[model samples]
Target: MSATASFLARRAAQKERVRILYRRALKDTLNWAVHRHLFYEDADRLRERFEANKHVEDLETVERMIADGEATYNKWRHPDPYIVPWAPGGTKFTRNPTPPSGIFIEKERKI
Candidate 1:
């Protein structure tokens, strides 16, 4: 029973990694694609690569493939990935954070 649970937990983690990798790869692809139509084409090709491996029933193979994909992504990742202005590490992040309410500091008057 413990073995089955361990296998399932590991499998779930691997699946999550694959999802993250795919999203990162897709976004990185967008960084390189200068036009929307080209991005769409790249996205479709990316989906096909994932779908091609969807039928593998072997857990070990799946694990290996996920690892390989992650390595590839990290190796060729964008040097400066695009970030939304309001997101963390973005230009507008915390740009104008709201001040705490009801706290006022009066400037000291100079003589």
Candidate 2:
């Protein structure tokens, strides 16, 4: 690949990684904050932390920062992050799963 193409591909991958990191951090904030007020404050701080490096144009530096952030987040991540009761891996997950194909419940409506 040309140097420009390689840089563009790396930039796109970096953007995806950054997006994932931010979302993970936000959800982890919810796990740590019991009250909405505190959560908002924590979220803002997290945003500031990200914004602090928003202007760094160097790809290597951004990658290094991303790696550092991921490491720190993993170090402090909640042991049991909150999951919606009905979501996958949740307590209610698959509790009332759909019936098998051979066991149809409702009859089909004729057109």
Candidate 3:
């Protein structure tokens, strides 16, 4: 691959990795925060952490920062992440094939 193409590919991959890391960190913060207000504060702090390094022009430095961010996120990851009550992963939403109780079906009328 040409040097420019290789650089662009590496940069794109790095951006994707950073995006994933940011999302994971945000969700992990939710696990720690009890209230929505607290979560907002924590999310802002996380954004600031990313914004602080948003202007580095060197690819090597950006890669190094990405590595550091990943390491920090891994070290601080929540042991048990919180799942939304209505989400697929949560207990309330998961169900078997059987229909829920209390629904009565009406007999179809012949025309």
Q: Give me the candidate number with maximum TM-score.
A: 2
> TM-scores for all candidates?
0.78, 0.87, 0.76
For residues 23-89, could you state the per-residue lDDT of candidate 3 as single tens digits?
A: 8898899999999999999999999989998878688998899899889998998887877876887
Alpha carbon lDDT of residue 47, candidate 3? 97
Candidate 1 Cα errors over 4 Å, as ranges? 100-111
- Better candidate by lDDT, 1 or 3: 1
Question: Model 2's lDDT to the true fold?
Answer: 0.95
Q: How many residue pairs clash in each candidate?
A: 0, 0, 0
Q: List the residue pairs that clash in candidate 3.
A: none
Residue 77 in model 1: shift from native, Å?
1.0
Summarize candidate 2's per-residue lDDT along 72-92 as a digit string, tens digits: 999999999898999998999
Clashing pairs for model 1 are: none
Task: Assess the local accuracy of residue 14 in candidate 2 as a C-alpha lDDT between 0 and 100.
Answer: 97
Off by over 4 Å in 2: 104-111
Better of 1 and 2 by TM-score: 2
What's the best-to-worst order under lDDT?
A: 2, 1, 3
The order of the candidates by TM-score, greatest first, is: 2, 1, 3
- Candidate closer to the true structure by lDDT (higher is better), 1 or 2: 2
Residue 57's lDDT in candidate 1? 68
Better of 1 and 3 by TM-score: 1
